[model samples]
Target: LKVTIAQIDIPCSFGPAYEGERVRGKDLFVQAGGGKTQCTEYLELADMKEIDDGKVTVIGPDIPDMKRGEVFPLGIFVQVGGREFQKDFEPILERQTHHLVNYIQGVMHAGQRDIAWVRISDAAVDKGFTLKDLGVVLHAKLHQDFSAILDKIQVTIYTKKEDVDKLTAKARAAYKYRDERVDKMTDDDVETFYSCTLCQSFAPNHVCTVSPERTGLCGAYNWMDCKAAYQINPTGPNQPIEKGECLDPKLGQWKGVNEFVSKASRGAVTHYNFYSLVQDPMTTCGCCEAIAAMLPGCNGVMTVHREYTGETPCGMKFTTLAGVMGGGASSPGFVGHSKYNITQRKFLVGDGGLLRMVWMPKSLKEEIRERLLKRGAEMGCPDLIDRIADETVGVTEEEIMPFLKEKKHPALDMEPIVG
Candidate 1:
């Protein structure tokens, strides 16, 4: 493992100073994902014998080939191979892309996995920024930061729509495999939940208490991933937090967690609930995979995913909802959560769990239909997926009420959502 820490070779200035900068529409050259086009990212551990270090490949157009404002597809495939690299380390390295991509002076990265959205600014294009520069940045920084555990890095960028689609499908399968690692475990199974402040740069006061079932809001780091991260760098953003006496089992609040949240949030937030969105929910960040909002008129809640650009039953579009709560504030009646957490056993159980999900974007609902069906059976609502309304049924609670009542959506018959 004699990897040399090389200065990142790119035309643009890069560092953490530019991470908070945004590429407004006026400066946007071209973008990917963000509900406009498909963007997927994935990292896997490979055999050292199979991959070459510092190798970067691009499958389609570079930055110059596209005109301004054209949305394009992108797939970032990174392979890290080393004698000490274990499969468990893949996610830990993969998540670094969120902030690492933002390290560039004019680049903006949001979301994660198949929902990734990236923007390249006109200034970056003037500086000769290319798709391959993405590869270069990842290769250099990953090795420099994790060289103790990282040996060789290989990156492949796909700009072709077909290629990006293929990668998206493949990445989704990998994401499912990673998410299931904690399926059988419950929050009650552990006394300590790990804390992930990795996204704090984007949402300075935000802190995620990662339990076995509650994956990080970005849908990237789960409890198992954070555990491995702490092992790699004890002083890093991921830290273990002992769960002190339970103050409220239904809302999932703990004394130790409250204390840690206060200190970690710099006293900006003193406490939050893990299982109830109607109460003081966890602080939200900009890149959450989905945002759940209360549907006051429907006696349930509705969530919109990052990839859906349509109006939700809650009246606000996904982007509007994100902009309002993405700033690391614990907004009651709304919460940021991973899409996987939707089907988890304890997901807002205090607020009626999946049985209370009244609306979702059509694509998101269909994408998770199979899982929803399985979870629905457990909740004794075997056809709950069919009962949930989408944009097709209507994006307003009034328009969806007749539909929910007609379909016998369990939420309509459940206890009132608002006290």
Candidate 2:
């Protein structure tokens, strides 16, 4: 193994020990994304001649120039150039930003892709940390850890709103293309599913099993990403598990997957479903792109994404829901999932599928409107997207049920959501 320790030059003490620390409202000096501002992280394969190794650039105002409580848009664009590097490796390296950025003391990172969030603490600022140091840490750490596959790295950190907005649009398109790469395939097409324990660093008991239809909750690692990750490092966290016995096909359970998850989570999670959100659903970690909670009054589920700070019909804001169940626990009637998974064919299929989604934040509803409509059409409910309630419609089940009933929302007539 060709291993070279990273020569990190940040002012703050950097290591995995600080991974779980939080930068709260009182201590937060400045922040990016987390629904406060736009934050996007994109990593792409590049030509060897395109980038200078270790070159880190800040395109806008640095941390020292920012005032406390200010929310600045951010785009961390990483270009990796190496003969061994493949485009398939982009998502894996990009997802590493969550943990790698958190390694810096007084800094907390959550989410992935366009919904990524970063908070810099007053402590880190006092220690003379800058946005440049984030680039420095990621550049050094990526090279140090991925030396086998990459040879050159360049990072650009953008704080300008215009620049970040453009990157967010471009990044979202790339994400869509990457996600569709596995759209035509199904879980039964292959005898194996991959495991993603990447978030285990923060949510120690969380074990994310990536099937063809269900992507990782963080919205970064899909089945293809995990498979590629495993191919690169056989003994790494993304290992393949053969689909053994079909213990419960309705809920999408496999005997081999249960055994693997039980051992991997140290027995914290013995089994979970790939298709159902209300029954033994997969463990949720804090970085999920969105969360779904059952709303009994509406006789359906309400979902809230990290970007939507508004109150959901379930009576919890995005941050509150994440705080309560996002700690690597299996909570019935609640499950964390990727935004892309929301439109997938098997999303909550065991609980009557997309027709059961009664409410979502307006922003989230519009963001996935295209795919949502497509999935709705497949279920023979072309107007389901319009029928779904949002914050504008009402933020409480009782308030939304009237509208749902008037609009003839499908969930009202479905089977009971809670057993």
Candidate 3:
């Protein structure tokens, strides 16, 4: 069996009619004029026959299967006598039919308008028809007309099976390439700057700026992706980080970052200082992502992640300490007093250190402790491994100190301890 497909255009109209029940014995009369009839005459012309025994199916406006404003195929099917007929029929059809040619032209034009597209799925070769013969019938009558339409429209075609496979492979390769590129960013790969315009919804006067080396306290976009996205759409939601000038290298302070923060935060962040934990310096916050409250009397920093009930040093209730900390100029590294305290030794030495009680949800607490222990070991502060790894709630200073000692860590020996 040989199959051929063609596309055609049609016009249609519609009207509404109501049906009524016939009265008793009298003959019922129905009005048929409400329905439409073709007022114009249809012109027909004899076209060439590709195969001697082929049957032509003309699809026009008269066809009930045609949908309003939709395009459909005027199909043709042919049964060849044998292999010779299969091989020879297509060439004969090409020399004969103008119907196929016109159909192809109409389809191509419609397709270019992004209106209608079509696909033909038939294996003529398996059905005892020569591909060359089929190709000729398609090419002479359809392919050439479709190509003409291509000149006036934007249409793409995949003829060979291998071509479709190649396209699929290429798409997969592109996605893989993108994924790998994103996965390669390290902590030091690129510097990130973050600002939360989103927070403006709740805190009209607040803006949170984040850096590349660290994540936003709220844990939004990382530095690299954030920077890349900003570069992609500068006028979009996320703006690029414009590095101004180096303020202090040892402390990672920059003039541009400070200016941006002050402007974005609406002067909420005025005095931007880096390093030297004290003396009119250090990062300040309105509300922080997590608050590492320092108990001066206890000489320890208590880290409250979020959704924890407790009294903070600043005496503020926190849902997420990060909510307050998310957009600050300070680094997440400086969570506890060890990072910002004037007397670092007070928190860094002996039984009393910056991090004392880590008040976090059970899940987050475990994650933080595990991560800190690993980082501490890498920093050669093995003593901190046990000190921060074990749970801190309800543990007395004495018990905490023994754990610190067990980890072979030394106590604070600063010259002047600050309250």
- Model number with the top TM-score: 1
Report the candidate with higher TM-score, 1 versus 3.
Answer: 1
What is residue 218's positional error in candidate 1, in angstroms?
1.2
Predicted structure 3: lDDT:
0.33
Give RMSD to native, each candidate.
1.1, 1.5, 24.8
Candidate 1 lDDT by residue in tens digits, 1-419: 46776688999999999999999999999999888898899999888887889999999998889999999999999999888888988888988898899999899998888888899999999999998999999999998889888888999999999999898888888899999998999999999899999888888899999999798988898899999999998999999999899999999999999999999999999999999899999999997989999997999999999878888888799889999999999999999999989998899998989899999988888888888999999999899899999999998999999999999888888889898
Q: For candidate 1, which ten residues in a row score worst on lDDT?
A: 1-10
The candidates, ranked best first by TM-score, are 1, 2, 3
Clashes of 1: 0
Residue 409, candidate 2: Cα error in Å is: 1.7
Candidate 3 lDDT over residue span 1-419, tens digit each: 32333522221110111011111212211100001110110111122232332222222222233322322322122222233222212222221122232232111110100011221112211233211232234333332332211111111222233443443354334323322333434323445454544334334444444443333333323344345444433553346555456665544456776777677667876534333232222343322324454433333444554334443433444434444543344433334121112112222222234334322234334544544554445445643534442234333344444444454332233223243
List, residue by residue over 52-129, the lDDT tens digit for candidate 2.
888999999999889988899999999998888889999999988989999999999988898888999999999999
Q: Compute each candidate's TM-score over C-alphas.
A: 0.98, 0.97, 0.41
Local lDDT at 3 for model 1: 76
Residue 338 C-alpha lDDT in model 2 = 91
Q: After superposition, how far is residue 90 of candidate 3 from its true place, in Å?
A: 53
